[model samples]
Target: MSELITIIASLIALLSALYARWTWSEAQKANKISRLNMLLALKQHYSELMLKEHEKARAWGKDDSYAEACRNSYADYQIKYRETSKELENFHARIVADNI
Candidate 1:
């Protein structure tokens, strides 16, 4: 009877350990997916910003003042860069907090 009880307890422990391992593996996979999604979003934003800059430059006429064009481009890039940086920082903080 004792041997039977020991076998049953050992089986249960083994099952529990397997379940824990599986859960950890799934969590790792989910983390990787989330990071990938974040990376894609960042890339998309960067591409969009670059496209807008390209369009702005293309729209400029030969008569357009060089100084003004340079100033506007710099200002626009700075604003967009700061906004995206803040957003990413907030997103990262949230993810870290949730994971913790």
Candidate 2:
């Protein structure tokens, strides 16, 4: 009867160890999923900000009065503005591609 009791106790210990290991694995997976969701939300927020910037830049480009003022105030303003806008657009495109 003592030998039988010892065997049962050993089996119970083994089962407990396995259950703990499985629970730990599940927790790790849940943490990874939560982290991934947060990263995706952050990326989406950044994308929205970039889009807003792009719209603002385009609006500035469309305003003839603003362009004239810039041109008069700075000789290379138009060139610089166009270049910067292009760079921003390229960066936005890259971000969109990465998300996809």
Candidate 3:
């Protein structure tokens, strides 16, 4: 009876280990998916901002107050877009490294 109890305990331990491993793997997969989604969102946001900045630039000139404001806003958006792009590149590199 003692031997049987020991065997059962061992089996239970093995099952628990497997369950933990599976759970960990699933969590990793979820994290990867979440990161990918964030990357996509950042890209989309940067693209939209860039397009709007371009539109503002094209409509710029005339030395009017509104034009000046638009230009300033465009410059700010340009800086932000560049920073976001750099972040996206770094994130992509990290994800690639993780896969390797």
lDDT of model number 1: 0.72
Measured by lDDT, the strongest candidate is 3
| Ten residues in sequence with the least summed lDDT for candidate 2 | 70-79
Please provide, for model 1 over 1-91, each residue's C-alpha lDDT reduced to its tens digit, 9 standing for 90 to 100.
9999999999999999999999998897688668757765875676576667666666675446764675577567667766767776776
Candidate achieving the largest TM-score: 3
lDDT of each: 0.72, 0.62, 0.80
Root-mean-square deviation of every model: 6.2, 10.1, 2.4
RMSD of 3: 2.4
Q: List the residue pairs that clash in candidate 1.
A: none
In candidate 2, what are the lDDT values of residues 40-62, reduced to their tens digit? 55555555555555555566877
Pick by lDDT: 2 or 3, better one: 3
Report the error of model 1 at residue 14, Å.
0.4
N/CA/C clash count, model 3: 0
Error of 3 at 21 (Å): 2.3
Clashes of each: 0, 0, 0
